[model samples]
Target: MTFDPTPPHEPRRPPPRSALGPRQLVGAILVLLPVVLLLGGLSRCSFAPGGPEIDPSAGPAVDAPALLRDAARLAPFAVRIPAVPPGWRSNAVDRATVAGGPGTAVRAGYVTGAGRYLELVQSDAPEEALVRDVAGTVPPPTGVVDVGGTRWVVYGGDEALWVADVAGVRLLVTGSAGEDEFRTLAEATLAGETLPAGTPPPR
Candidate 1:
Protein backbone atom coordinates (compact mmCIF):
# COMPACT_ATOMS: atom_id res chain seq x y z
CA MET A 1 0.00 0.00 0.00
CA THR A 2 1.34 3.44 -0.88
CA PHE A 3 1.89 5.67 2.25
CA ASP A 4 -0.51 8.65 2.45
CA PRO A 5 1.43 11.86 3.43
CA THR A 6 -1.65 14.17 3.96
CA PRO A 7 -1.69 15.78 7.44
CA PRO A 8 -4.37 14.48 9.94
CA HIS A 9 -7.56 16.61 9.98
CA GLU A 10 -7.77 19.07 12.97
CA PRO A 11 -10.42 18.21 15.57
CA ARG A 12 -13.63 20.32 15.33
CA ARG A 13 -13.99 22.85 18.29
CA PRO A 14 -17.52 23.29 19.81
CA PRO A 15 -18.91 26.84 20.12
CA PRO A 16 -17.84 28.70 23.30
CA ARG A 17 -20.53 28.23 26.03
CA SER A 18 -21.38 31.09 28.45
CA ALA A 19 -21.60 30.23 32.15
CA LEU A 20 -24.89 32.19 32.34
CA GLY A 21 -26.65 34.69 30.05
CA PRO A 22 -27.43 38.10 31.57
CA ARG A 23 -31.19 37.45 31.37
CA GLN A 24 -30.87 33.99 32.95
CA LEU A 25 -28.64 35.32 35.68
CA VAL A 26 -31.08 38.14 36.45
CA GLY A 27 -34.08 35.72 36.56
CA ALA A 28 -32.22 33.31 38.83
CA ILE A 29 -31.26 36.12 41.24
CA LEU A 30 -34.83 37.42 41.30
CA VAL A 31 -36.21 33.95 42.16
CA LEU A 32 -33.60 33.33 44.85
CA LEU A 33 -33.78 36.77 46.54
CA PRO A 34 -37.02 36.13 48.36
CA VAL A 35 -35.89 32.71 49.59
CA VAL A 36 -32.63 34.17 50.85
CA LEU A 37 -34.47 36.96 52.69
CA LEU A 38 -36.99 34.54 54.19
CA LEU A 39 -34.22 32.31 55.46
CA GLY A 40 -32.40 35.31 56.95
CA GLY A 41 -35.58 36.46 58.72
CA LEU A 42 -36.21 32.97 60.09
CA SER A 43 -32.69 32.81 61.45
CA ARG A 44 -33.26 36.05 63.40
CA CYS A 45 -36.59 34.92 64.88
CA SER A 46 -36.57 33.06 68.23
CA PHE A 47 -39.35 30.76 69.46
CA ALA A 48 -38.46 31.36 73.10
CA PRO A 49 -36.68 34.43 74.38
CA GLY A 50 -34.72 34.81 77.63
CA GLY A 51 -37.03 37.39 79.21
CA PRO A 52 -39.66 37.65 81.94
CA GLU A 53 -42.97 36.06 80.99
CA ILE A 54 -46.08 38.15 81.33
CA ASP A 55 -49.34 36.76 82.72
CA PRO A 56 -52.25 37.96 80.64
CA SER A 57 -54.84 37.02 83.23
CA ALA A 58 -53.20 38.83 86.13
CA GLY A 59 -54.61 42.29 87.00
CA PRO A 60 -54.24 44.94 89.68
CA ALA A 61 -55.39 43.88 93.13
CA VAL A 62 -58.08 46.25 94.38
CA ASP A 63 -60.47 46.18 97.34
CA ALA A 64 -63.80 46.54 95.55
CA PRO A 65 -65.95 46.10 98.66
CA ALA A 66 -64.18 48.80 100.63
CA LEU A 67 -64.23 51.15 97.67
CA LEU A 68 -67.92 50.53 97.25
CA ARG A 69 -68.55 51.26 100.92
CA ASP A 70 -66.63 54.52 100.65
CA ALA A 71 -68.50 55.47 97.50
CA ALA A 72 -71.84 54.59 99.13
CA ARG A 73 -71.06 56.90 102.04
CA LEU A 74 -70.26 59.85 99.73
CA ALA A 75 -72.23 59.38 96.51
CA PRO A 76 -75.58 61.07 96.16
CA PHE A 77 -77.04 58.04 94.35
CA ALA A 78 -77.20 54.53 95.75
CA VAL A 79 -74.32 52.10 95.26
CA ARG A 80 -74.16 48.32 95.00
CA ILE A 81 -71.14 46.05 94.87
CA PRO A 82 -71.73 42.76 93.09
CA ALA A 83 -70.16 39.54 94.33
CA VAL A 84 -68.31 38.48 91.19
CA PRO A 85 -67.29 34.85 90.77
CA PRO A 86 -63.96 33.52 92.01
CA GLY A 87 -60.87 34.42 89.98
CA TRP A 88 -62.43 37.80 89.12
CA ARG A 89 -60.57 40.96 90.17
CA SER A 90 -61.40 44.64 90.51
CA ASN A 91 -58.79 46.85 88.89
CA ALA A 92 -60.21 50.33 89.01
CA VAL A 93 -62.61 52.53 91.01
CA ASP A 94 -63.02 56.26 90.56
CA ARG A 95 -65.63 58.99 90.28
CA ALA A 96 -66.44 60.52 86.92
CA THR A 97 -68.45 63.60 86.09
CA VAL A 98 -71.48 63.29 83.86
CA ALA A 99 -70.92 64.83 80.44
CA GLY A 100 -72.91 67.95 79.58
CA GLY A 101 -74.97 67.47 82.70
CA PRO A 102 -75.29 68.15 86.42
CA GLY A 103 -74.47 64.82 88.09
CA THR A 104 -71.63 62.60 89.25
CA ALA A 105 -70.83 58.99 88.24
CA VAL A 106 -69.31 56.25 90.35
CA ARG A 107 -67.44 53.66 88.32
CA ALA A 108 -65.99 50.24 89.17
CA GLY A 109 -63.91 48.18 86.76
CA TYR A 110 -63.37 44.46 86.92
CA VAL A 111 -61.28 41.89 85.11
CA THR A 112 -63.41 38.81 84.72
CA GLY A 113 -62.39 35.23 85.46
CA ALA A 114 -61.77 34.76 81.75
CA GLY A 115 -59.47 37.81 81.50
CA ARG A 116 -62.10 40.11 80.03
CA TYR A 117 -62.48 43.65 81.37
CA LEU A 118 -65.79 45.36 82.14
CA GLU A 119 -67.09 48.38 84.05
CA LEU A 120 -70.20 49.40 85.97
CA VAL A 121 -71.32 53.00 86.34
CA GLN A 122 -73.92 54.29 88.80
CA SER A 123 -75.22 57.80 88.28
CA ASP A 124 -78.27 59.97 88.63
CA ALA A 125 -77.63 61.41 85.17
CA PRO A 126 -80.08 60.68 82.36
CA GLU A 127 -79.34 57.74 80.10
CA GLU A 128 -78.23 59.85 77.17
CA ALA A 129 -75.93 62.06 79.23
CA LEU A 130 -74.48 59.17 81.18
CA VAL A 131 -73.81 57.21 77.99
CA ARG A 132 -72.05 60.23 76.54
CA ASP A 133 -69.95 60.41 79.71
CA VAL A 134 -68.86 56.75 79.59
CA ALA A 135 -68.69 56.25 75.85
CA GLY A 136 -67.18 59.00 73.75
CA THR A 137 -70.29 58.99 71.57
CA VAL A 138 -73.89 58.35 72.57
CA PRO A 139 -75.35 55.58 70.45
CA PRO A 140 -79.06 54.95 70.10
CA PRO A 141 -80.47 52.00 72.02
CA THR A 142 -80.42 48.95 69.73
CA GLY A 143 -82.67 46.80 71.92
CA VAL A 144 -83.91 46.06 75.41
CA VAL A 145 -83.39 42.88 77.41
CA ASP A 146 -85.44 41.79 80.41
CA VAL A 147 -83.04 40.23 82.85
CA GLY A 148 -84.28 39.16 86.27
CA GLY A 149 -87.45 41.27 86.03
CA THR A 150 -85.40 44.36 85.14
CA ARG A 151 -85.10 46.00 81.71
CA TRP A 152 -81.58 46.67 80.40
CA VAL A 153 -81.25 48.88 77.34
CA VAL A 154 -78.67 47.51 74.95
CA TYR A 155 -76.58 49.75 72.71
CA GLY A 156 -73.83 49.29 70.11
CA GLY A 157 -72.99 46.03 68.31
CA ASP A 158 -70.41 43.49 69.55
CA GLU A 159 -68.85 46.06 71.89
CA ALA A 160 -72.09 46.40 73.80
CA LEU A 161 -73.35 48.93 76.39
CA TRP A 162 -76.16 48.08 78.79
CA VAL A 163 -78.21 50.59 80.78
CA ALA A 164 -80.82 50.05 83.46
CA ASP A 165 -82.63 52.34 85.89
CA VAL A 166 -82.63 50.70 89.29
CA ALA A 167 -82.74 51.86 92.91
CA GLY A 168 -83.13 55.55 92.05
CA VAL A 169 -80.02 55.52 89.88
CA ARG A 170 -79.09 54.70 86.32
CA LEU A 171 -76.86 51.65 86.13
CA LEU A 172 -74.68 51.25 83.05
CA VAL A 173 -72.61 48.15 82.31
CA THR A 174 -70.05 48.27 79.54
CA GLY A 175 -67.05 46.06 78.85
CA SER A 176 -65.35 43.39 76.76
CA ALA A 177 -67.07 40.55 78.62
CA GLY A 178 -69.53 38.29 76.79
CA GLU A 179 -73.31 38.76 76.95
CA ASP A 180 -73.59 35.93 79.47
CA GLU A 181 -71.16 37.74 81.77
CA PHE A 182 -73.05 40.95 81.25
CA ARG A 183 -76.26 39.23 82.31
CA THR A 184 -74.52 37.79 85.32
CA LEU A 185 -73.37 41.25 86.39
CA ALA A 186 -76.84 42.69 85.84
CA GLU A 187 -78.46 40.00 87.97
CA ALA A 188 -75.91 40.49 90.70
CA THR A 189 -76.44 44.24 90.66
CA LEU A 190 -80.19 43.78 90.94
CA ALA A 191 -79.87 41.26 93.74
CA GLY A 192 -77.33 43.37 95.68
CA GLU A 193 -78.74 45.49 98.48
CA THR A 194 -79.05 49.22 97.92
CA LEU A 195 -76.49 51.21 99.88
CA PRO A 196 -77.45 54.86 100.30
CA ALA A 197 -75.09 57.60 101.42
CA GLY A 198 -75.31 57.70 105.20
CA THR A 199 -75.16 60.79 107.37
CA PRO A 200 -71.87 61.30 109.16
CA PRO A 201 -71.88 60.75 112.91
CA PRO A 202 -71.16 63.72 115.22
CA ARG A 203 -67.38 64.23 115.59
Candidate 2:
Protein backbone atom coordinates (compact mmCIF):
# COMPACT_ATOMS: atom_id res chain seq x y z
CA MET A 1 0.00 0.00 0.00
CA THR A 2 1.37 3.44 -0.88
CA PHE A 3 1.99 5.34 2.38
CA ASP A 4 0.04 8.64 2.37
CA PRO A 5 2.60 11.41 2.44
CA THR A 6 0.19 13.64 4.36
CA PRO A 7 0.20 12.78 8.05
CA PRO A 8 -3.25 11.98 9.61
CA HIS A 9 -4.97 15.31 9.68
CA GLU A 10 -5.21 16.51 13.30
CA PRO A 11 -8.79 17.56 14.29
CA ARG A 12 -9.11 21.34 14.00
CA ARG A 13 -8.78 22.65 17.57
CA PRO A 14 -10.93 25.63 18.79
CA PRO A 15 -8.92 28.68 19.79
CA PRO A 16 -8.04 28.14 23.46
CA ARG A 17 -10.92 29.64 25.56
CA SER A 18 -8.41 31.13 28.03
CA ALA A 19 -10.85 30.23 30.86
CA LEU A 20 -13.27 33.03 29.73
CA GLY A 21 -10.95 36.01 29.83
CA PRO A 22 -12.50 39.51 30.24
CA ARG A 23 -12.56 40.12 26.49
CA GLN A 24 -14.37 36.81 25.77
CA LEU A 25 -16.83 37.44 28.61
CA VAL A 26 -17.43 41.02 27.38
CA GLY A 27 -17.96 39.83 23.81
CA ALA A 28 -20.34 37.07 24.92
CA ILE A 29 -22.23 39.54 27.07
CA LEU A 30 -22.39 42.04 24.19
CA VAL A 31 -23.82 39.36 21.90
CA LEU A 32 -26.38 37.85 24.31
CA LEU A 33 -27.46 40.94 26.28
CA PRO A 34 -29.45 42.50 23.45
CA VAL A 35 -31.38 39.25 22.90
CA VAL A 36 -32.12 38.97 26.65
CA LEU A 37 -33.28 42.58 26.75
CA LEU A 38 -35.50 42.12 23.69
CA LEU A 39 -37.10 39.03 25.24
CA GLY A 40 -37.64 40.87 28.55
CA GLY A 41 -39.17 43.85 26.79
CA LEU A 42 -41.57 41.64 24.82
CA SER A 43 -42.85 40.04 28.05
CA ARG A 44 -46.00 41.78 29.30
CA CYS A 45 -45.62 43.29 32.76
CA SER A 46 -47.64 45.67 34.92
CA PHE A 47 -46.81 47.76 37.98
CA ALA A 48 -48.54 50.43 40.05
CA PRO A 49 -47.45 53.96 39.35
CA GLY A 50 -44.27 54.91 41.19
CA GLY A 51 -44.81 56.84 44.43
CA PRO A 52 -45.34 56.25 48.15
CA GLU A 53 -48.74 54.77 49.00
CA ILE A 54 -48.97 56.91 52.12
CA ASP A 55 -50.86 60.20 52.08
CA PRO A 56 -48.63 63.23 51.51
CA SER A 57 -50.43 65.38 54.10
CA ALA A 58 -50.20 62.71 56.77
CA GLY A 59 -47.69 63.26 59.59
CA PRO A 60 -47.08 61.77 63.01
CA ALA A 61 -49.54 63.11 65.59
CA VAL A 62 -47.87 65.72 67.79
CA ASP A 63 -48.73 67.25 71.15
CA ALA A 64 -49.97 70.75 70.34
CA PRO A 65 -49.43 72.05 73.85
CA ALA A 66 -45.97 70.56 74.14
CA LEU A 67 -44.96 71.92 70.76
CA LEU A 68 -46.22 75.38 71.66
CA ARG A 69 -44.34 75.29 74.93
CA ASP A 70 -41.16 74.33 73.15
CA ALA A 71 -41.68 77.05 70.57
CA ALA A 72 -42.39 79.61 73.27
CA ARG A 73 -39.05 78.78 74.84
CA LEU A 74 -37.37 79.41 71.52
CA ALA A 75 -39.24 82.63 70.75
CA PRO A 76 -38.08 85.72 72.67
CA PHE A 77 -41.60 87.07 72.87
CA ALA A 78 -44.66 84.95 73.57
CA VAL A 79 -45.89 83.07 70.54
CA ARG A 80 -49.59 82.52 70.00
CA ILE A 81 -50.60 78.94 70.74
CA PRO A 82 -54.20 78.58 69.73
CA ALA A 83 -56.40 76.37 71.84
CA VAL A 84 -57.07 74.37 68.70
CA PRO A 85 -60.67 73.19 68.98
CA PRO A 86 -61.59 69.61 69.74
CA GLY A 87 -60.48 67.12 67.05
CA TRP A 88 -57.88 69.66 65.86
CA ARG A 89 -54.30 68.41 65.60
CA SER A 90 -51.00 70.24 65.43
CA ASN A 91 -48.80 68.58 62.84
CA ALA A 92 -45.60 70.61 62.90
CA VAL A 93 -43.83 73.62 64.45
CA ASP A 94 -40.81 75.46 63.09
CA ARG A 95 -38.57 78.03 64.75
CA ALA A 96 -37.00 80.71 62.62
CA THR A 97 -35.52 84.19 62.80
CA VAL A 98 -37.75 87.17 62.37
CA ALA A 99 -36.99 88.52 58.88
CA GLY A 100 -36.24 92.11 59.96
CA GLY A 101 -36.26 91.83 63.74
CA PRO A 102 -34.19 90.42 66.52
CA GLY A 103 -36.90 88.13 67.89
CA THR A 104 -37.64 84.55 66.87
CA ALA A 105 -40.39 83.51 64.47
CA VAL A 106 -42.57 80.50 65.15
CA ARG A 107 -44.60 78.71 62.50
CA ALA A 108 -47.18 76.11 63.44
CA GLY A 109 -49.25 73.92 61.14
CA TYR A 110 -52.67 72.72 62.16
CA VAL A 111 -55.43 70.40 60.97
CA THR A 112 -58.84 71.69 61.91
CA GLY A 113 -61.69 69.66 63.35
CA ALA A 114 -63.27 69.67 59.90
CA GLY A 115 -59.99 68.29 58.50
CA ARG A 116 -59.05 71.64 56.95
CA TYR A 117 -55.29 72.24 56.83
CA LEU A 118 -53.66 75.60 57.64
CA GLU A 119 -50.38 77.13 58.76
CA LEU A 120 -49.78 80.05 61.11
CA VAL A 121 -46.59 82.00 60.39
CA GLN A 122 -45.82 84.20 63.40
CA SER A 123 -42.87 86.17 62.18
CA ASP A 124 -41.64 89.58 63.22
CA ALA A 125 -40.89 90.25 59.59
CA PRO A 126 -42.39 93.29 57.92
CA GLU A 127 -46.07 92.67 57.25
CA GLU A 128 -45.61 93.41 53.56
CA ALA A 129 -42.72 90.98 53.13
CA LEU A 130 -44.46 88.31 55.19
CA VAL A 131 -47.69 88.69 53.21
CA ARG A 132 -45.73 88.51 49.97
CA ASP A 133 -44.04 85.35 51.17
CA VAL A 134 -47.37 83.76 52.07
CA ALA A 135 -49.33 84.88 49.03
CA GLY A 136 -46.54 84.85 46.44
CA THR A 137 -47.89 87.62 44.14
CA VAL A 138 -50.29 89.81 46.11
CA PRO A 139 -53.27 91.49 44.59
CA PRO A 140 -55.05 94.38 46.28
CA PRO A 141 -56.82 92.57 49.11
CA THR A 142 -60.06 91.16 47.70
CA GLY A 143 -61.34 92.35 51.07
CA VAL A 144 -60.61 92.08 54.78
CA VAL A 145 -62.03 89.82 57.46
CA ASP A 146 -62.01 91.07 61.03
CA VAL A 147 -61.43 88.50 63.74
CA GLY A 148 -62.17 90.19 67.04
CA GLY A 149 -60.16 93.40 67.08
CA THR A 150 -57.60 92.15 64.54
CA ARG A 151 -58.27 92.75 60.86
CA TRP A 152 -56.91 90.13 58.44
CA VAL A 153 -56.46 90.98 54.80
CA VAL A 154 -58.16 88.26 52.73
CA TYR A 155 -56.41 87.18 49.57
CA GLY A 156 -58.08 84.79 47.12
CA GLY A 157 -56.13 82.25 45.06
CA ASP A 158 -55.70 78.51 44.54
CA GLU A 159 -54.70 78.74 48.21
CA ALA A 160 -56.52 81.38 50.30
CA LEU A 161 -54.62 83.71 52.64
CA TRP A 162 -55.68 85.67 55.71
CA VAL A 163 -52.88 87.87 57.01
CA ALA A 164 -52.66 90.10 60.08
CA ASP A 165 -50.29 91.25 62.77
CA VAL A 166 -51.04 89.91 66.22
CA ALA A 167 -49.00 89.66 69.43
CA GLY A 168 -46.42 92.08 67.98
CA VAL A 169 -45.67 89.60 65.15
CA ARG A 170 -46.87 89.76 61.58
CA LEU A 171 -49.02 86.67 61.36
CA LEU A 172 -49.83 84.83 58.16
CA VAL A 173 -52.47 82.11 57.96
CA THR A 174 -52.87 80.31 54.67
CA GLY A 175 -53.66 76.95 53.16
CA SER A 176 -56.55 74.65 52.28
CA ALA A 177 -58.68 76.13 55.08
CA GLY A 178 -62.12 77.46 54.19
CA GLU A 179 -63.40 80.92 55.07
CA ASP A 180 -64.96 79.73 58.28
CA GLU A 181 -61.95 77.61 59.25
CA PHE A 182 -59.63 80.45 58.36
CA ARG A 183 -61.60 82.82 60.57
CA THR A 184 -61.42 80.31 63.41
CA LEU A 185 -57.63 80.14 63.16
CA ALA A 186 -57.31 83.91 62.95
CA GLU A 187 -59.47 84.34 66.00
CA ALA A 188 -57.46 81.81 67.94
CA THR A 189 -54.15 83.44 67.08
CA LEU A 190 -55.34 86.99 67.79
CA ALA A 191 -57.48 86.06 70.76
CA GLY A 192 -54.56 86.88 73.08
CA GLU A 193 -54.32 83.35 74.46
CA THR A 194 -50.62 82.36 74.64
CA LEU A 195 -48.53 79.34 75.48
CA PRO A 196 -47.15 79.17 79.02
CA ALA A 197 -43.56 80.40 79.32
CA GLY A 198 -42.38 77.02 80.51
CA THR A 199 -38.67 76.47 79.92
CA PRO A 200 -37.99 74.06 77.09
CA PRO A 201 -36.28 70.84 78.20
CA PRO A 202 -32.49 71.41 78.08
CA ARG A 203 -31.53 70.88 74.45
Candidate 3:
Protein backbone atom coordinates (compact mmCIF):
# COMPACT_ATOMS: atom_id res chain seq x y z
CA MET A 1 0.00 0.00 0.00
CA THR A 2 1.36 3.41 -0.99
CA PHE A 3 1.46 5.78 1.97
CA ASP A 4 0.02 9.14 0.93
CA PRO A 5 1.63 12.27 2.51
CA THR A 6 -1.75 13.94 2.37
CA PRO A 7 -3.90 13.10 5.35
CA PRO A 8 -7.12 11.29 4.47
CA HIS A 9 -8.84 13.56 6.95
CA GLU A 10 -10.15 16.71 5.28
CA PRO A 11 -7.66 19.55 5.74
CA ARG A 12 -8.93 22.69 7.47
CA ARG A 13 -10.14 25.18 4.77
CA PRO A 14 -8.05 28.00 6.32
CA PRO A 15 -11.04 29.06 8.36
CA PRO A 16 -13.58 29.40 5.49
CA ARG A 17 -12.85 32.48 3.36
CA SER A 18 -15.29 35.45 3.43
CA ALA A 19 -17.72 35.52 0.47
CA LEU A 20 -17.97 39.33 0.83
CA GLY A 21 -15.89 41.34 -1.63
CA PRO A 22 -13.85 44.42 -0.58
CA ARG A 23 -16.77 46.84 -0.74
CA GLN A 24 -19.00 44.38 1.05
CA LEU A 25 -16.31 43.88 3.66
CA VAL A 26 -16.43 47.62 4.45
CA GLY A 27 -20.23 47.48 4.64
CA ALA A 28 -20.05 44.44 6.87
CA ILE A 29 -17.80 46.35 9.24
CA LEU A 30 -20.38 49.10 9.44
CA VAL A 31 -23.18 46.62 10.01
CA LEU A 32 -21.34 44.78 12.71
CA LEU A 33 -20.21 47.94 14.56
CA PRO A 34 -23.42 48.25 16.48
CA VAL A 35 -23.39 44.58 17.35
CA VAL A 36 -19.81 44.77 18.53
CA LEU A 37 -20.62 47.89 20.50
CA LEU A 38 -23.72 46.33 21.99
CA LEU A 39 -21.85 43.20 23.03
CA GLY A 40 -18.89 45.17 24.38
CA GLY A 41 -21.19 47.53 26.30
CA LEU A 42 -21.99 50.77 24.45
CA SER A 43 -21.17 53.11 27.30
CA ARG A 44 -17.75 53.75 25.76
CA CYS A 45 -19.07 54.77 22.35
CA SER A 46 -18.21 58.38 21.47
CA PHE A 47 -21.18 60.54 20.47
CA ALA A 48 -21.90 64.20 20.02
CA PRO A 49 -22.98 65.67 23.32
CA GLY A 50 -25.77 68.24 23.17
CA GLY A 51 -29.47 68.71 22.85
CA PRO A 52 -31.27 67.33 19.83
CA GLU A 53 -31.63 69.60 16.83
CA ILE A 54 -34.86 71.57 16.59
CA ASP A 55 -37.23 71.00 13.71
CA PRO A 56 -37.84 74.39 12.10
CA SER A 57 -41.07 73.32 10.41
CA ALA A 58 -42.60 72.51 13.78
CA GLY A 59 -42.47 76.24 14.67
CA PRO A 60 -41.50 77.71 18.02
CA ALA A 61 -44.02 76.99 20.73
CA VAL A 62 -43.34 79.38 23.58
CA ASP A 63 -45.50 79.93 26.65
CA ALA A 64 -47.04 83.36 26.09
CA PRO A 65 -49.51 83.35 28.98
CA ALA A 66 -46.85 82.58 31.53
CA LEU A 67 -44.54 85.15 30.03
CA LEU A 68 -47.25 87.80 30.25
CA ARG A 69 -48.08 86.92 33.84
CA ASP A 70 -44.43 87.24 34.83
CA ALA A 71 -43.83 90.42 32.83
CA ALA A 72 -46.84 92.14 34.37
CA ARG A 73 -44.88 92.51 37.58
CA LEU A 74 -41.70 94.06 36.13
CA ALA A 75 -43.20 96.21 33.39
CA PRO A 76 -43.44 99.96 33.77
CA PHE A 77 -47.16 100.12 33.11
CA ALA A 78 -49.88 97.53 33.32
CA VAL A 79 -48.86 95.04 30.66
CA ARG A 80 -51.89 95.38 28.40
CA ILE A 81 -52.05 91.95 26.80
CA PRO A 82 -53.80 92.46 23.50
CA ALA A 83 -56.40 90.00 22.33
CA VAL A 84 -54.89 87.59 19.83
CA PRO A 85 -56.06 88.54 16.37
CA PRO A 86 -57.61 86.00 14.04
CA GLY A 87 -55.13 83.29 12.99
CA TRP A 88 -52.47 85.14 14.95
CA ARG A 89 -50.98 83.62 18.08
CA SER A 90 -48.66 85.12 20.64
CA ASN A 91 -45.64 82.88 21.25
CA ALA A 92 -43.79 84.61 24.04
CA VAL A 93 -43.94 87.63 26.29
CA ASP A 94 -40.87 88.91 28.09
CA ARG A 95 -39.56 91.91 30.01
CA ALA A 96 -35.97 92.90 30.61
CA THR A 97 -34.39 95.77 32.43
CA VAL A 98 -32.01 97.77 30.29
CA ALA A 99 -28.43 96.94 31.14
CA GLY A 100 -26.57 100.02 32.46
CA GLY A 101 -29.67 102.19 32.09
CA PRO A 102 -32.84 103.06 33.94
CA GLY A 103 -35.29 101.46 31.53
CA THR A 104 -37.34 98.32 31.04
CA ALA A 105 -38.45 96.58 27.85
CA VAL A 106 -41.53 94.45 27.46
CA ARG A 107 -41.74 92.28 24.34
CA ALA A 108 -44.51 90.11 22.95
CA GLY A 109 -43.72 87.72 20.11
CA TYR A 110 -46.40 86.49 17.76
CA VAL A 111 -46.97 84.39 14.72
CA THR A 112 -49.44 86.44 12.69
CA GLY A 113 -52.72 85.11 11.42
CA ALA A 114 -50.87 84.75 8.14
CA GLY A 115 -48.15 82.63 9.85
CA ARG A 116 -45.60 85.42 9.62
CA TYR A 117 -43.70 86.40 12.79
CA LEU A 118 -43.49 89.80 14.52
CA GLU A 119 -42.78 91.14 17.96
CA LEU A 120 -44.27 93.98 19.97
CA VAL A 121 -41.79 95.79 22.16
CA GLN A 122 -42.79 98.43 24.67
CA SER A 123 -39.96 100.10 26.46
CA ASP A 124 -39.03 103.28 28.24
CA ALA A 125 -35.50 102.91 26.92
CA PRO A 126 -34.21 105.77 24.79
CA GLU A 127 -35.59 105.73 21.26
CA GLU A 128 -32.26 104.80 19.71
CA ALA A 129 -31.61 101.94 22.11
CA LEU A 130 -35.10 100.48 22.08
CA VAL A 131 -35.40 100.67 18.31
CA ARG A 132 -32.08 98.91 17.94
CA ASP A 133 -33.12 96.16 20.28
CA VAL A 134 -36.51 95.38 18.69
CA ALA A 135 -35.97 96.01 15.00
CA GLY A 136 -32.19 95.59 14.83
CA THR A 137 -32.39 98.57 12.48
CA VAL A 138 -33.62 102.12 12.98
CA PRO A 139 -34.12 103.13 9.38
CA PRO A 140 -35.38 106.65 8.99
CA PRO A 141 -39.09 106.54 9.75
CA THR A 142 -40.54 106.40 6.24
CA GLY A 143 -44.19 106.96 7.08
CA VAL A 144 -46.88 106.73 9.73
CA VAL A 145 -49.78 104.29 9.92
CA ASP A 146 -52.80 105.43 11.90
CA VAL A 147 -54.33 102.38 13.52
CA GLY A 148 -57.42 103.09 15.55
CA GLY A 149 -56.56 106.34 17.39
CA THR A 150 -52.86 105.53 17.51
CA ARG A 151 -50.19 106.33 14.90
CA TRP A 152 -47.52 103.78 13.98
CA VAL A 153 -44.38 104.95 12.21
CA VAL A 154 -43.23 102.66 9.43
CA TYR A 155 -39.71 101.53 8.55
CA GLY A 156 -38.82 99.82 5.27
CA GLY A 157 -37.04 96.51 4.65
CA ASP A 158 -37.72 92.84 3.92
CA GLU A 159 -38.81 93.20 7.52
CA ALA A 160 -41.29 95.88 8.65
CA LEU A 161 -41.90 98.10 11.65
CA TRP A 162 -44.93 99.98 12.98
CA VAL A 163 -44.00 102.17 15.90
CA ALA A 164 -45.82 104.82 17.93
CA ASP A 165 -45.54 106.86 21.08
CA VAL A 166 -48.40 106.22 23.44
CA ALA A 167 -48.66 107.64 26.93
CA GLY A 168 -44.93 108.55 26.97
CA VAL A 169 -43.91 104.99 26.13
CA ARG A 170 -42.48 103.89 22.83
CA LEU A 171 -44.47 101.05 21.34
CA LEU A 172 -42.85 99.07 18.54
CA VAL A 173 -44.20 96.28 16.36
CA THR A 174 -41.40 94.86 14.31
CA GLY A 175 -40.42 91.67 12.44
CA SER A 176 -40.84 89.64 9.28
CA ALA A 177 -44.59 90.29 9.00
CA GLY A 178 -45.81 92.56 6.21
CA GLU A 179 -46.58 96.22 6.83
CA ASP A 180 -50.34 95.76 6.72
CA GLU A 181 -50.19 92.85 9.13
CA PHE A 182 -48.00 94.82 11.49
CA ARG A 183 -50.54 97.63 11.54
CA THR A 184 -53.40 95.23 12.09
CA LEU A 185 -51.64 93.88 15.16
CA ALA A 186 -51.04 97.39 16.43
CA GLU A 187 -54.71 98.21 15.99
CA ALA A 188 -55.80 95.09 17.81
CA THR A 189 -53.31 95.69 20.57
CA LEU A 190 -54.48 99.26 21.06
CA ALA A 191 -58.15 98.35 21.00
CA GLY A 192 -57.71 95.59 23.57
CA GLU A 193 -55.28 97.50 25.78
CA THR A 194 -55.63 97.03 29.54
CA LEU A 195 -53.48 96.04 32.46
CA PRO A 196 -53.59 92.37 33.34
CA ALA A 197 -57.08 91.94 34.77
CA GLY A 198 -57.33 91.37 38.54
CA THR A 199 -53.68 92.18 39.15
CA PRO A 200 -53.42 93.36 42.76
CA PRO A 201 -52.05 96.87 43.04
CA PRO A 202 -48.44 97.01 44.20
CA ARG A 203 -48.13 97.58 47.92
- Highest TM-score: give the candidate number: 1
lDDT over C-alpha atoms for residue 128 of model 1: 87
Candidate order by decreasing TM-score: 1, 3, 2
TM-score of 2: 0.61
Residue pairs that clash (backbone atoms under 3 angstroms), model 3: 87-113
Question: What C-alpha lDDT, on a 0 to 100 scale, does residue 62 get in candidate 2?
Answer: 76
List TM-scores for all candidates, in order: 0.69, 0.61, 0.62
In model 2, which range of ten residues has the least summed lDDT? 47-56
- The lDDT values for all models are 0.80, 0.71, 0.69
lDDT of 3 by residue, 1-203 (tens): 88878788976665344665788778879999999889787665444332222223357667665666567765766566666665666667777875544678888888765556778887777766776666565677788778887877777654667778877777788776666777777876777646642354445
Write candidate 1's Cα lDDT for 15-55 as tens digits. Answer: 55475678887999999999999999999765433222223
Candidate 1's TM-score: 0.69
- Which stretches of candidate 3 lie above 4 Å from their native place? 1-57, 62-66, 99-101, 196-203
**C-alpha RMSD of candidate 2:** 9.6
lDDT measured at residue 113 in model 2 versus the true structure, 0 to 100:
67
Question: For model 1, what is the C-alpha lDDT against the true structure?
Answer: 0.80
